[model samples]
Target: MAEPFSIKNKLTLMTEPAAAGHRMILSGISLRTGGTSRAPFASLNLGLHVGDDRENVVANRRKAAEEIGFSLERWVCAQQVHGTNIARVTGECAGAGATSPDTAVKNVDGLFTTEPDLLLALCFADCVPVYFYSKQPAAVGLMHCGWRGTVRLGAVRMVETMCRTLDLVPEDIYAVIGPAIAGADYEVDQTVIDEVSKLGRGIRNGAVTPHGDEHYLLDLQALNRAVLIRAGVPQEQIQVTGYKTSVFPELFYSYRKDHGRTGRMMGFIGMKNKGEGTS
Candidate 1:
């Protein structure tokens, strides 16, 4: 495997280093106080549609928004279906896709905006959260990359979409691969192993196991970074937060670690002028 990339966060919020002029904050609420009491849902569960208590999830999202200086009323998120569709944001369409006080967006995994006031966020649990930013064009984007999204090269596609639709150049973009299931803890079936191995760029020697039918540990973060590189984003421009969501249950939620019934964490990206900004 390549050298591991780590996501550096500021204060207690979960932020990624790869994205500049933006923040990738993650929530740290616990299950007992903030999460649903369902056995699988546990605590701090923010997914309202996942059978968690609606009131608690709403409260949690509001608290998170306040902490990050964004209005929950203005934040927009798509109903994620793991497809590669990327939506462009505008002032007239602000808060157009949010589902409820606890849910938003109907079927998009990628969100991009040059609109300064609209905050875009995606919910994650063991899925790789990717953040995007550009200095010259002055825009930011965020994406949720599960294994399906990564295998589909969603990270690379997001960069390309920005370049094609938003007039962003690859060299000016900074991509950060946020926390997810790392290679060591991410064991996959033979089919997945073979598919990733064919990618040729991310598969490391001994990353796969030959015993009992070829199970392998897939490195989603590294593979996603490879996709960004292939899309023309420089290696240094790609900041990786190799934090394992499964490893930090206290600070973030993990679907696999908590057995598919855990709370969610939010990864956000927004652009603000350096000297003159809105609070």
Candidate 2:
């Protein structure tokens, strides 16, 4: 693989390639360096629920849509309650969560669709942006998994749901574990570690490490990867970007690092219109 993601424009970190024909996975994770918001938000805030000015957030979203080549109207968003709830949407659900958070697919952290040209989006600061897709049926999914979502096996749920809905086996799914806080930066108390430990030693062995004083360093990417592997997604097919959002202040906003007052980046995944593209 030759770098699964790259900086495409001022607004997004491109992934998979957006010019590989109709079946290409057209998706991008917004960077915090552009747009109109100021100060705490100071630019590129794709989340409306955050305290940023609505107009500025909308403007930022438009910029992202334009750069990613996905129409703003065809986009579907979720309120992201940090749960494992995944919604399967279609053309009829177009524009569900575009400008307003209220209209976003109510309380879902994950969204998927086999229909083309419909983008599924969610916002993030430090949480994992788990992307899923399968070529045979032409589908894409985006999920928000924080420690809570990960402990609940959100990645496995998404894979299982996609497999069940598409009538395919887990091997058919291709997963991407996008940017998020790295283990060195994500220390959790015993409560969190205890839940994670329940995931079995194989999963916990690579993801959870004692941080001293009852705290533990948790590698969310590894945990999600382990669960996905358990769900039957081939280890080789799954890609972990190794991009840590918390470490890049100029390029990303970290809720934990920023002390809860910061802008959000959009994680968008969608299939482009026919002949309209991604790699």
Candidate 3:
């Protein structure tokens, strides 16, 4: 498993040699980080709707954007509804949801754009953060995939959107499965098991296993990878971090581990300015 380098205090960055110069990151929970939100939603919480102080969330977002060489004005995000809907971001949508939830691209879980300098971001605790980039078109994308989004095949939707809107083919696309709860720490009820089982044999193979009492452990990373492969993304073109949020409290926030009283890490991807170098 490849590790994201910590730029400062637990905030980390994930980059791939294959993606050329695209920037992708998975933030960590660290007190020294820049947000002013208080305990529980402490320090670096980038989520605006998670009961954190609005001012603090904004400050944290500004700091993250600056660190990545993106201005707050160019940061684009969405109101993640845990669905498969994907939005094609453009210059007009830049800065939406960067400071508040109301202005976000409504009810969407995935955001993609070919526009340079537009930073696409999404919040997550245990939900899988899937990233997409294409060298051919110089495009990038980010998706929030929880159990609902996974069963709905959010990755496939993002691929299809990129194909339709950006004329990108799945074979030319590169993807990364960022940190989330691992199978060992994630237990689901029979309802979730049934829904995931409907995804097909390729996805069901090692993705779900029986736990005591009508409950099962689900591997969201594996499930999303399978969906991407089925959508035409080659296996070698994808990267899985394998970093389980539940197992690393000091490094990340986990909704299930903290019983819903927790902050969220940010997953971001964007193309750099034409003359700018990778950070």
Of 2 and 3, the candidate ahead on lDDT is 2
RMSD of 1: 4.2
Q: After superposition, how far is residue 256 of candidate 2 from its true place, in Å?
A: 0.5
Residue 20 error, candidate 2, Å? 8.9
Identify the leading candidate in terms of TM-score.
2
* Tens-digit lDDT track of model 2 for 1-279: 445678877788978553323566777799998799998997888889889999899998888888887778888999788899999999999988898888899988999998988889899999999999888788899999999999999999999999899997999898888889988999899999889989898889999889789989998988998999998999898888857898888889999999999999989898865665532
- Across 143-188, the per-residue lDDT of candidate 1 in tens digits comes to 8888778777788788998898767689978777777876777778
Q: Model 2, poorest ten-residue lDDT window?
A: 16-25
Q: Judged by lDDT, which candidate is best? A: 2
**All candidates: TM-score:** 0.83, 0.96, 0.91
Per-candidate Cα lDDT values, in order, are 0.67, 0.87, 0.79
In Å, residue 31's CA in model 1 sits off its true spot by 11
Candidate 2 Cα lDDT to native: 0.87
Clash pairs of candidate 3? none
Clash totals, every prediction: 13, 8, 0
Candidate 3 structure quality by residue, lDDT tens digits, 1-279: 455433453445545333344433322222224567688987788888988888888888777666666788887889888898988889999889888788999989999887777878888899999988887777888889999999988898998888888777899887888888989899999999889989986688769889999999999999999999999999888888757888877777899998999888888887765456544
